[model samples]
Target chain A: MISFQHVTKIYPRNTIAVDDVCFDVEEKEFVSVVGKSGAGKTTLLKLLLAEEKPTQGEIFFQGKSINEIKPGNLPEFRREIGAVFQDYKLLPSKTTHENVAYALEVIGASDQEIARDVPKVLEIVGLTEKANNFPEELSGGEKQRAAIARALIHRPEVILADEPTGNLDPYHSLGIIRLLLKIQEMGTTLILATHNREIINSLGKRVVTLEDGRVIRDERRGRFIL
Target chain B: MFTSLKRVIRSGWQGFFRDGGLSIATVFILLLTITLATSLFLFHGLSHLLISSVEEKADISLYFKEEALENDIFEFREELARISEVKEVKYISQEKALADFTEKHKDNPVLMASLAEVGRNPFLASLNIIASEPGQYQAITDFLETSDFTALIEKVDYYQRRSVIERIFSLTSTINRSFIFLSIILSLVAILVTFNTIRLAIYNSREEIKIQRLVGAGSWFIRGPFLVQGVLAGILAALICLLTFSLIIWSLSPRVETFFTDLDISQFFVTNLWQIILIQFVTGILLGVISSFLATRRYLKI
Candidate 1:
């Protein structure tokens, strides 16, 4: 479980990226953060990932304040939370298998574990055939799947997908949405930030809508309403 | 710990080969820097040899009075040896001096006739004196002037050769200073160029680094490979430079020895083979690793 208590992030030049906003996600819940451009959705996720500290407030992961977490312990914290991005963030030089195995390798997984889990995860993403293919060699959908495989290989407790389907076509986007739903069914908490109205309307999950750095609405089984 | 090390090395190996062209280029530049460093090191050794050789050639000759007894001069020689400044003293008797002159002009009839005409071994008995340090020559000269046997002394050749000795001393000092300055400047340039080259190589992998951080890699895990690559570059460069220098010295030794009869550069290198290799290896590896570490540190920070 994760909680944000009145977190605010202000960049230089007096720009408020995220205002004093607060939210929480229960264990195994699928939460969607919906907003147009400049809604502070990405800023919220960044704070959760500890990529940037909240300018003024605290973030809690599993009852521990993430803001007080030492830098040396960040890798351990990050290992428990998987992140997928819009750009697919796969290492270009690495094959799909290597990319997936990388996540486990970072956590010092055994070679046997890497070999076993990587193939299994790739298979789940329907990318087993493209295991040896580099990111450049894969299609957009395949690349996204590879990224997903990397994010899920370690079986992280929480998965944060920030516009993961932003660059995909409608068919690929639908496939990714279905993949997210399947992952959620497996009991992994999912926090997806997107402006994709069709996916939001289709999911009918808990939605948190933001407008100009403030959370304007929070609804249970909400629709894509501005 | 072993597992971490194994993983780091494995990832390093993969990263090295994965960025093939850029990695090779980084290694090559490291090679060049190593080669220059090795050459400078060898040149420094050679300079020391040349300086000592020049110092050995510059000694003062002390001529004794015509009536001065050989026994007294020998006793003076013993006393001179006791002085801390005097490195060595050679006694050249009047008879030996005359014989040396005759032996030199035996084939030249006119010169032999001129030497015979002078007759009666005109050369004076002398003591050739060398100082432990060039600056200490003045101390030895002062000692000779104030010695108890000063009355038996005919002339000290030091005053006549003072200017030449001074010139040689200053020349060697200038050479040493210039060599050190030049090496420092070149080393800085080499390090900067090498650092920038590796930085560019790392810059090309920025996306990979970001991705690695995103996937929860510790800083060391991502940096280990680049560091290994740097060390590899250093080792390869050092080996190449060693071979090149050995070959060059081997080929040029005979020709150089022809001009400077006592100096055999090839023999010197061979005699100190292990030391030469060690210096080159350490220099190469140090430059490679240090430059790579500095260049990659900033980028690896997640």
Candidate 2:
């Protein structure tokens, strides 16, 4: 459902982050983007989120070109996709429950819907017992779970995990991968970008590899090969 | 719309309580600004009263010669009353003047002995002329000097009081102009400080703002809470300032009355209490709401 049509992103200082990269993922597919550091993985996700505009190419979501979406209509486009980052990006002042409910609240969800769905999503991420704990009070794994809960709370059409386990321990990292798999079972498209060899090898899904700002490999049931 | 409003209010309350330190700082600044505003209002009232009291005390006294008939003096009074600059004229006869002096010094032995030694009215029978303005006093004096009855006039007291009256008039005008200028300067500074404080407060929430945008919250949904917080701070600060000013005026009223007997501070407050409160509330709310609105404009666009 997500497609990048030869997108190239160049920063203002003439530094190219993503160059002429083209790819697509069908609906309800779990796709992993594997690359070494600074291989345009993060840039790809940023372009899809419309956080940074492509310097020379267009991006498409479903059948519509996202590069042409008006600035005012951008929020509507973002609501359809959920994103989790390595930082967890939880509002430090908010409790785990608040962090998850915030996503629903932003979408103007009804109070009843929020009260019901938030707890359910928190339970799915195994954070139900720590709902009242702030980010500083939680462990790294718990923080990532909270972030995952926030991403899945809105039942977005696609979930983009940008180094979701970059800061977690191996055990916690495995837990996050399992959580992503569980979410994919619920029919949500999942795009994971990471340099983790174990994750890429275990996924048994489509893998796109990038090098020097360009896509160098696209393989089915791909193994981790840098 | 109601649902959105409810959410906005809830979010505002959450943000206010969540960022306790920043929220407290914002409210404190608002309180200080409102206090300054209220004090300026009170000072304006007191200054007006002082200036008017001085104006009331400034007047010209026309003394008639020993041979001038009472009827002639009364005719001069009528003619002087016709002058456009004259606000009022009171004619005091020699008999009445004598009686007034004796009544004023009945208990003072020295003054009583002196009055008895003179055996006749030592005071002049005169008409006291008050001009509508200090600048007009000189015009009245000139008119009196050139009148047909100037030969019968003993003296005009306008010259003796002219410099003092003019000084008081200039002082009052200077005070008024300076007060206005100072108020403008202080208000501008207060607004700038308030805007910066609110901007910093919003900057702390930049990440949450980005997240909120990603979740498809409309710009108004995110902005409504900060605006509400500003308005709340303004209202609370205004109420506190009103109470503080009322107490201050109450406590200082008796002492201030000693210097300005005609003005009743408590009475002024009581009469204009509603109007003062309205002004304070409007200023507080406008400052708070506008600052919040402007500070968050750039951040909310994302």
Candidate 3:
């Protein structure tokens, strides 16, 4: 459902973060983008989200050029894809439930739907008990779970998870990976960008590995290979 | 649309209570601004009252010679009244002026004896000419000096009193101008301070704003709460100021009257109560809403 045509992103001082990369993911596919730090993995997802424009080439989502999305319509475009970052990105002042419910609220969801869906999603993330707690009051795992709950609340067509488990312990990291697997099994497209060796090796799913800003390998049953 | 608006307002209300420190700080800044603006508004009126009282003391009196008939003095009074520059003209007969002088110095034996020594009615029938403006007195005195009946006038007191009148005129204008300048500076300071406070509050929420944008919240959805917060602060500040001013003005009226007997400030406040409330309400709400609106716009671009 998403395609990148010879995309390149060059920063100031001539740094090539992504160099003429090309890839596509079909609807409901689970794609793992593997790279070490500075391997252009994050930059690829950022292009899809339209957070940054590629210095050259084009990106398309559902066959529509993402660059063509007007500023006025960007919010609607974004509502189609959910994002979970390494930092959790939960509002510090909002309670766990409020953070999750915010996604629905922004779209003018009815009170009954929000009341019904927020808790169900929180339950899926196993954070139903901590619904009223603020981010600062939650543990690292709880905070990550809350962030995941928020990303899944609206049942977005695609979930772009960039280094979501970067700050977790081995157990919590594995738990998060399994949660993502559960989400993928439920037929949601998942684009995971991470440098973690175990996650890429164990997933062994459609892997597009990047090395020095170029995609070096693409395999259906890929493994982590330096 | 109605559903969206209701949600936006509720979100704003929640955000207000959620961010305690920022909300309190915003309300405090708005309150400070409202108080300053309201006081300056009232101060402008009070200064006008004081200036007018001083102006009342500077009118020129034309005392006619004892030989000038009452009819001539009355005719002169009628002519002076016709001058648009003149605010008022008072005719005091010779007998009335003497009676006034005796009544004023009744307890002062020296002045009483001096007045009695002058024997007969020594006072002249006079026409007191008060001009609309301090500068206009010059025109009135010039008319008096050049009049055909100048021969019947003993003296135009404007020349002798010109220095005092001129001093009052300059002093009133200076105070009037300085107050206006000071009010402008204070208002600017108030606006900048509130703007900075709101900017800082929004800056604190920058990361959340970025996340919210990515979460698919529309710009208005994200900004709704802050705007509501601003308008809420404005309403609160306006109410507080209104109650405070009303109580203060009502209670302080009698006490302030002792210092300026003719100026009943309490009565003025009572009469203009609605107008004052409206000004404060509009000022507080506009400042609060506008500053928040601007502060949020800079961060919502993401």
True-contact fraction per candidate equals: 0.69, 0.56, 0.78
lDDT by residue (A1-226, candidate 2, tens digit) is 7788888999989999999999899999999998999999998998998888999888999999988998889888888999999988888877898889888877778989999898888888888899999899999999999999999999999999999999998999999999999999899999999999998898899999999899999998887797
Which DockQ values do the candidates obtain, in the order shown?
0.68, 0.62, 0.75
How many clashing pairs per prediction, in order?
A: 1, 0, 0
Please give, for residues B182-215, the per-residue lDDT of candidate 2 as tens digits: 9999988888888888888888888877777766
Best by DockQ: 3
lDDT of each: 0.88, 0.88, 0.88
After superposition, candidate 3 runs with Cα above 4 Å error: B102-119, B247-252
lDDT of 1 by residue, B14-107 (tens): 7778888887887788778877877787788887888889888888899999999999999999999999999999999999998898788789
Which portions of model 2 show Cα errors greater than 4 Å? none
Clashing pairs in 1: B12-B225
| lDDT of the structure predicted as candidate 2 | 0.88
10 residues in a row with least lDDT, candidate 3 chain A = A102-111
Q: Which TM-score does chain B of candidate 3 obtain?
A: 0.90
TM-score: model 1 vs. ground truth: 0.93
Instruction: Give the best candidate by TM-score.
Output: 2
User: What ranking emerges by lDDT with the best candidate at the front?
Assistant: 3, 1, 2
